[model samples]
Target: MHDVEAPPQERTRFQWWHHSHPTFAGITGFFAGMLFVTALPGAFVGVLRLLFSHDTAEQLFPFVLLALALPIFMLVKRKTRRFAQFMFVGMLVTALVVLGVTSLVLYFMVDA
Candidate 1:
């Protein structure tokens, strides 16, 4: 019998989402989008509270927006899998950038 050479296995880059289920990714994206979206209204409320009323309850009122995530996710996820995944990842990235910039601004503001 003649000796036969075996084919080499293909290597794939390490991607956190690659090993995760699409449903999980989509769900994660939904939550991230919710958090990012909610933060905007929350921030506005917080600023208003700081400027006029000092009520902590009003400042924390934005937490209610978190509940909207489920419906939004359901609507978008039904449209397409790729779109949901992209939206989730995009929201997370946006949150990260916003947080970083805010931190830098606060640091400078406090120092000055």
Candidate 2:
């Protein structure tokens, strides 16, 4: 049996997950950079607040950790051409981790 080519219409159909569009990557990278930048001041403030209250300290500590992603991304990007993709993934991971931890803490604190 010989291999058959895909139909022309099928070939032209959009494969949403098969391609990494540059514009999409750039947009994601921009937001990721923005988020990384935004978290920095928040982490700084959180650290300062930590000095005054244990509760606030626990809540804010994670943000300080979250702020670390930006520097890590920058370092990784410096050595690779796929910086945008890296930034996008890093941002998403950072956001999810930070949000998940924060939500869990709040849930426990409220329940207690």
Candidate 3:
């Protein structure tokens, strides 16, 4: 018996990001997008909190807007555009859900 090894295929950093088929691509992209969407902010805030006081961190929070450039770049590039679209959708949905839940909670608490 003999075993043969396959040569490694070369892929760009993001080339293998999406699954082969569209269906799985969307599903995986959605979750991956969600994770990437959350992680950036989480990391920024974590770093700010570690390095600065609350008021300073609050003041600097707006700087996080700069992070939007990454997705914008991804969207502009042809290879990453598809994945970036899914990431954009995931980010939008996450923001909406967070606001909706927060509003409902505040409404219930304040109105009661």
**What number of backbone clashes does candidate 1 have, counting pairs of residues 3 or more apart or in separate chains?**
1
Candidate 1 vs candidate 3: which has greater TM-score?
3
TM-score per candidate: 0.40, 0.34, 0.73
Question: lDDT of each model, Cα atoms only?
Answer: 0.64, 0.66, 0.79
Colliding pairs, model 2 = none
TM-score for candidate 3: 0.73
Clashes of 3: 0
Q: For model 2, how does the per-residue alpha-carbon lDDT over 1-112 read when each residue is reduced to its tens digit?
A: 9999899888778554343665555555657655764676676876678586867766666666765665566656644335556565667777787789999999999999
Model 2 residue 47 lDDT score: 66
Which run of 10 residues does model 3 get worst, by summed lDDT?
Answer: 5-14
Please write out the lDDT profile of model 1 over residues 2-99, one tens digit for every residue.
97755443223333346356665566666667665657577767666777656775766666667557545655765555545655666667778889
Q: Of models 1 and 3, which has the larger lDDT?
A: 3
Clashing pairs in 1: 29-88
